[model samples]
Target: MTTTPDAGLRQDRHLATEIPGPLSQALMARKDTAVARGVGTTMPVFAARAAGGVVEDVDGNVLIDLGSGIAVTTVGASAPRVVEAVEQQVREFTHTCFMVTPYEGYVAVAEQLNRLTPGTHEKRSVLFNSGAEAVENAVKIARAATGRSAVVAFDHAYHGRTNLTMALTAKAKPYKHGFGPFAPEVYRAPLSYPFRDGPDVDGGAAARRAIEVIEKQVGPENLAALVIEPIQGEGGFIVPAAGFLPALQEWCRDNGVVFIADEVQTGFARTGAMFASEHEGLVPDLLVSAKGIADGLPLAAVTGRAEIMDAAHAGGLGGTYGGNPLACAAALATIETITADGMIERAREIEALALARLERLRDADPRIGDVRGRGAMLAVELVDPATGAPDAELARSVAAAAHAQGVIVLVCGTYGNVLRFLPPLAISDAQLEDAFDVLAATFTELS
Candidate 1:
């Protein structure tokens, strides 16, 4: 398929050699010494160039990308608009530091965020370097606005790797293992895990259960905010029951607690809706966004009601490089791409294509205990057929097989049994079908 010259890589998947051929292996050896041990890669193949739906590795293998750099590159690895914008911005100026000199790109980005984020109410935005930073700032604004200390995150939540966000996150091994004494005043509540929690509890019931926990453990009067992902990301592509988010939001409003929607992974048309929060009309008090916002640039933002966002003092809210001009230009262009390119509908089309395949697999294979998610962001939970217990080994085997066959997939969950698929909206129907063919074969082989 033809693509822009800037996005020079092809859209097709072609394995020129073994998965991680000698060149990649040599690079891996170098990376072992040069990079920190804490950083880990899902696929061993080193990328030489990437564009559209495929990533070309150092060994010349063009592998179909299903993970999309952990839901970052929604438009494509090298989308034309994003590339053009960044190229133009770099030629003009890379960074003057918005805090010191100020610029149009940063203000334009903030304006876009305020306008595009859910809710028609007057909103304000602040930029940051990462999702964790956006979330930290959101919490700060919440506390400043409400004069409260405690914030509640849900079970199976994956916030970020920072000190405060580590306390906010639910998983402990990799993200929070040795990082204690974590930031204080952070609490965890239960999430509406439909597959595991069983059939009896619907969204409302699950919300009440969580509310009860919040009320008992950390009272409403003491709470600053209740942060959540409408569709949980690293906690598995967990889509909570229909009314759960609204229920929690209403409670937050009544209790004078800020409702923060951490849309780091679910925003910017990743789900069928522009924001996953829109699925149920969840107009959060504050929305922390990153990942897909800048088409792979290091950018994040917290958009919220004007009053709450303005609570923080002028000197209290910014960093030297929070809103780099290049990143802002990328964000503006990415937003334009999403709107002009009909990416929201593309995400729905992907949902229709992938969900049907996954549902059929679930129906045929007992090991596929659950297949759930929204739009391009989808996942399947692997479980033991006999006992219905989580089969993390099976998940790993399936992922490894997919990787060996030149398809990129990622495994995540509290139990580590969920295989999440987040293909770029730019992915072709043929490439997606081919990836699924490989996945089907891998599952059958493992079975």
Candidate 2:
């Protein structure tokens, strides 16, 4: 319940002018010239400072932050503990390269990953700079251990944007449109999207169908890994049906394929659980983590069974800035805050508030085809009411409308019809209510 000092500004939404007011519009011009065209932004307003649940823009507009920078700032951007840790670490030696000289902070983070990641088995961890790197390393470990080449990913899965990860990812438009030729040997299986798959196709049936596809398309013996997000992230916050994860884990166990849980988005209590796998009692052989790991700093990890992680020969894994001292320090403080500051319980509370509000919204709107996901990682899928077709335009309109009113929202899904809500765990209930009010108003205005 600790709040960061607001520096004489209140922690409530306050719009001094229209969003992206004069100053922000000027910055946007500069960004257009300096930044890459491929890079996209959700809000045009450049953030000057952020604390708790609000981000103050360059134009002095206080906007309610619902996206959390794509769920990276779970502890809130500029969290006191994380900032303090980073400052202290920077004063100390910043980097000696963990692979070359080594440091305690790196080992400490690896130890934390080993302990925090699911499974009581002997675990080892390797640090990476991003979720994509962690996923690629997980695949490497699986292949090295099993000596198999083919990897199985789900239909709506989003692993990362790296060459191998892009191959594992399902969406092709933005993530993989012109980025080919992608890496080979990655296969996609049917995911249990209950909303789209009809009522009869439950978790067990979905698992069977996916397994059948794997058997036919990529032989079980040839598969090195079965990578999945226990609660899917960018491919819309699609939470697979119950028993789907457990069944997949069992299949991976029965076959030689390693079960890798890509908890990049769902990790660190974003999904109302310590890890999304715990919801179904799944024990993935490899667990990938990032995003909320370091409270916005670049840090990712692959924690898995010791034997599998050690399958690679000496010096086979690692990067120059894999576990930078500052990032490690930030991660340690972030984890401590999550555990000691009751953020996990806060996540469950957030889930309750968000679902209650969103379910009400869905009840009133026919265009809302589905309201799904868990904890703070909730999303609403927009669809044409009459024909039941995905309505990407409606989704975009609602998000843009919300953004214009000083509430930052983000859109996702393969069809671009999902409006994801990833409020920070540290966000107050009042802030949440205010954001949802804006959301409701947007829907009312558009519908």
Among all windows of ten consecutive residues in candidate 1, which has the lowest summed lDDT?
1-10
lDDT, candidate 2, 256-302, per-residue tens? 88999999999998988889899999999999999999999999999
Runs in model 2 with CA error above 4 Å? 1-5
lDDT of 1 by residue, 103-211 (tens): 9999999999999889999999999999999999999999999999999999999999999999999999889998799999999999999998889999999999999
**Cα RMSDs of all predictions?**
1.3, 1.1
lDDT of the structure predicted as candidate 2: 0.92
Error of 2 at 193 (Å): 0.1
Worst 10 residues of 2 by lDDT: 1-10
Assess every candidate by TM-score: 0.98, 0.98
Against the true structure, candidate 1 reaches a TM-score of 0.98
Off by over 4 Å in 1: 1-8
